[model samples]
Target: RRQFLITRIYAPKAWWFGFCSSVYSIAGLWAGAALAIYAAMIEHKNVAVF
Candidate 1:
């Protein structure tokens, strides 16, 4: 049927879009955490030196 064909075409696109967005969000969170930890470490070192 025409509806079935249309659903098949769009389903994968929707799934792929969701998958990519989730991956991007996860990577962004990881990068943010890493930057926070690095900044804290640098601050700690500076405090100890002074």
Candidate 2:
């Protein structure tokens, strides 16, 4: 059926998948790094970051 156009079937979902996969990858990395820095610099007082 024309209603099942391939582009329409995959385009938006693919874009969302790409954004979620890539952006979440970096966001999660930074969030984890920040948590580690907080634990080391503030919680454990190992060194200075600010």
Candidate 3:
């Protein structure tokens, strides 16, 4: 019974870690995409000015 209790707690912690990591990865991807778009827009404006 003691071991089962420990296992139950550990399982949820592991699941939470997996969920958090996935969210982190998705956020990173979104930030990277936004940065790229902003950079492209700036370059476009610079080209037009030249």
Model 1's alpha-carbon lDDT is 0.82
Q: What are the lDDT scores of the predictions, listed in order?
A: 0.82, 0.76, 0.82
Question: Which prediction has more favorable TM-score, 1 or 2?
Answer: 1
Q: Give lDDT tens digits, candidate 3, residues 5-27.
A: 78668798876787899999999
Please identify model 1 stretches exceeding 4 Å from their true place. Answer: 1-10, 44-50
Ranking by TM-score: 3, 1, 2
* lDDT for residue 7 in candidate 1, whole number 0-100: 72
In model 2, residue pairs whose N, Cα or C atoms come closer than 3 Å (at least 3 residues apart or on different chains), thus clashing, are none
TM-score against native, each model:
0.66, 0.55, 0.66
How good is model 1 by TM-score? 0.66
